[model samples]
Target: MPIDHKQPYDESNIFARILRGELPAKTVFESEHALAFHDISPAAAVHVLVIPKGAYVSWDDFSANASDAEIAGFVRAVGETARIVGAEPGGYRLLANTGKRAGQEVPHLHVHLFGGQPLGPMLAR
Candidate 1:
């Protein structure tokens, strides 16, 4: 489904809960602007998620509402997490699904860094 620009941020979302310490996450990186952790259901040998500390419902919401520093720092954290997980030199794929149809299971804005092996094409033929 296409992202609903009007969708309000859900404080109870899984990512939000993790940020609030209400839920446990195997955190890999944390900064004032972002948080990175391992994905519960990994798609690759190395799969990490980088999320903004703020309440952003999607990538569009993040780009539109977050500060420049926040945006830059969050992206940097994604790279940092990838390198820490040994996914940088081998290469990795960064992805963000904006809505349900795009496979976003949560409402919070997050970037997925996946690598540690040949990831193949973007889609199945």
Candidate 2:
């Protein structure tokens, strides 16, 4: 099954529902620009998803032409979410997968924070 990045937020996606407060999420942190929550399908012991609240589909939607405030908010939200998720003190990894080829099951622009347990090669270049 191919993940469609074009249809990032068509309202049917789980993250969309979460953003709209239509679905229940273990919310870690939230600001005007972003929301952070626990991943229902967690890869690590502590997996948090930090996402912007705008209509931007993916990281491309953000990095390509987001405002300075948007970019700053994104970075700050990711850091705040990491701290809230206990990732700051213990250390964590922030990941944003762009397209289908990168294993981005969801199209929304989100940063995944994983930690609590030792995270090796989680972001190996």
Off by over 4 Å in 1: 1-5
lDDT of 2 by residue, 7-119 (tens): 64566767888888899999888888888888888989989999888767788877876788888988998988887777789788778887777777776788888888988
Per-model TM against the reference: 0.93, 0.87
Q: Go through the candidates in order and give the C-alpha RMSD of each one to the true structure.
A: 1.7, 2.2
Please give the distance, in angstroms, between residue 104's alpha carbon in candidate 1 and its true position after superposition: 1.6
The ten-residue window of minimal lDDT in model 1 covers 1-10
Query: lDDT per model, in order?
Result: 0.89, 0.81
Query: Candidate 1 residues 1-125, lDDT tens each?
Result: 35454489989888999999999999999999999999999988998899999999999889998999999999888888887898889899999988766877788898989999999999766
**Stretches of model 2 off by over 4 angstroms after superposition:** 6-9, 122-125
Q: TM-score of the candidate numbered 1? A: 0.93
